[model samples]
Target: MTIPAATASFHGIWPALLTPLKPDLGIDLHRFGLHARALVHAKGCGGVVPFGTTGEGPSFSVDERRDAVDALVGEGVPASQILVSTSCAALPDTLALTRHALAIGAHGCLMMPPFFLKGVSDQGVIDCYRQVIDGAADDRLRLYLYHIPQVSGVGLSRKVVETLKRLYPQTIVGIKDSSGDTAHTLALADAFNETLMVTAGHEPDLPELARRGSTGAVSGLANFMPHVVQRLAGRPDAPNTPHDVSRVRLLLAMLGPYALTPALKGIMAALSGEPGWLRVRAPLVALTTDQMHTLQHALKPIALDVDVD
Candidate 1:
């Protein structure tokens, strides 16, 4: 299939969307679409990233992810505005998800190494990616490597990323570094600034990274605070002020104690006054009543600043 000219380069803030679930714990396709549209049009996000770490990508089945993508696009969010993460423990499953995203016209695919089996050899990592790129073998496939060692336990070494870029220069485009280390984010930009599009997960460092040639971010904080991320990304030379930085940090601090996905969902629920937002899939639990009250208290200033309903 002739792919449309690459839909906008992978630059600017792309929120790692927080999946909204129903009471039955099924994906809430309606709320999902609403969130995508609001983030892009209202909050000024360049686009939306579904099925990333923040979106709890691995927890949902391939069918659910596919449906969510279709729902977002059907709701009038352009396919170019969606960056789908297709990281699964199984290769066939990953290929299926990647192919589906490409067929549907997503901006690109953010992929991780087969992370379930940790301690994989370097060559093993390369070959794993090779199989997916070669297997899908589609011209439209724009793959962005995902390197969040803290969660995935599989870090894409510089050598691995460089080799892949050398091998699949067109198909393998960039990476989302969620390593949470400024030095590592800076080094990746320094090394591959010209070739690879590096997006930092650390929101505070986005402006500096952008100045250093990194493209943008796939940020968790942007789920609620896209304007902050957008403002920082839109003006790379002028970083966010200390007050802006503190506000972002405050939200991070408040949510840091709880399991992140649920805490975020609770905050969303409280802000929107939609109880369904608190529903998470198995292996994840919602915040307790006490915790919900606490999150509300801490996030009050941020909620006012963001002007959420």
Candidate 2:
């Protein structure tokens, strides 16, 4: 489970990415790679992850993830540039995933806290990470802690990063601040300025973060909207940057709230010309006909290319 010394850099605009699938619900690893290659080859996309929350990461089996990584890397994307999110429910599973990712030559892996229990203490969260880092035995295993407190319930508390950094400076590495808390991220930027790369998960906040010496984002919008991601990412520190950010927010507004997920899946389906692209895994329903009608009304005009024709 040792991450090679040669593979430690995790940077830039990595779309949390999605796993394209056949209508039959079979894993379309080939189509997945096609999407990956397209993103990797795109102007602003740094790399991709096959099984993120956006990728329906929880819904995939271990074998599917392994094959997905292989397929993407084989398509000419380098191993280091492709960061695999190994965020699972249990410690053993997380360790296995971490090791598997290391074996497949993923540059780094992301981890989510054990979400089965609510109101977890920071120590428990710390122990979970410590166990993963220790078990992997990979000094070069760059671990980006997923900080979506809303979903995970267990926030990786303010002290956790410092403790992890001290214990495993090279291995613990950075964080994906999806907490959406502007003040929290701002504090992190102020405190851990040079220590770790703090990525602003929200695009609207990127310009402000970039000004504060924060790194880029790990955005879902980028999965389907790569060109937009590039434009927003490259908005730069200048007077007119707010205008660009507002334009993106306007797009997000037009796209709607929950529309992001289905619409994103729709984008892949449309692009692949596989209209029966996928149905969200059971317990998670796909958009109804009326809902899709709403999507059609919303996306096409934005030049989002949601048509499968």
How many pairs in model 1 have backbone atoms within 3 A of each other, for residues 3 or more apart or on separate chains, i.e. clashes? 0
Displacement of the residue 112 alpha carbon in candidate 2, Å: 1.4
lDDT of 2 by residue, 89-162 (tens): 87887788889889877878888787778888888889989999999997658887788887678888888889
Query: Per-prediction TM-score, please?
Result: 0.94, 0.89
Evaluated with lDDT, which candidate comes out highest? 1
lDDT (Cα) of model 2: 0.72
Give the local distance difference test score of model 1: 0.82
